[model samples]
Target: MAAIMENVTFIDSSTCAILISAFKAMQLKKTGRLVLADSPVVQSLIELTRLHTVFEILPNQKSGIIGIDGRVKFAITIIGPVN
Candidate 1:
């Protein structure tokens, strides 16, 4: 599975922390996490939190969708032959 976060605006530090924990959990589960941060403010926050290294930060929603599609295809191929 994959996560697509678009046009997200965090109002508080707690919310950002919560998302960080969620992203870590997603990573542990081998889930693809993509963030669509077209806003400079959002990008700065992500960079400040160093989450850009943790998740794929895309400039637009289409990129995130493409990323998720690629990941899904890979996962399917990896699991398709399992009996």
Candidate 2:
């Protein structure tokens, strides 16, 4: 499986563990995207747990008018199946 991390995010061990298991399972299946958002909370947790590089991180954003504050808010599209 392939990891495509982006945005800003992270998760706890309980969550990361399950994801890791899923990743190992998917690796045997087909390559896919593993997007991660810019979430320091989750990122730190992953890091402390020694899983920062385990997943792919893609810190990118597509600029678009989302009626939030004119360039202040950017909507993101996560191209992956969480489950």
Best by TM-score: 2
* Number of the top lDDT candidate: 2
Q: Which stretches of model 1 miss by more than 4 angstroms?
A: 1-10, 61-83
TM-score of each: 0.47, 0.52
* Model 2, runs deviating above 4 Å: 1-11, 62-83
Per-residue accuracy of model 2 over 38-69 as CA lDDT, tens digit each: 44565667667766556543334343323333
lDDT of 2 at 78: 25
Residue range with the least summed lDDT across 10 consecutive positions in model 2: 70-79
- Pairs that collide in candidate 1 are none
lDDT of 1: 0.46
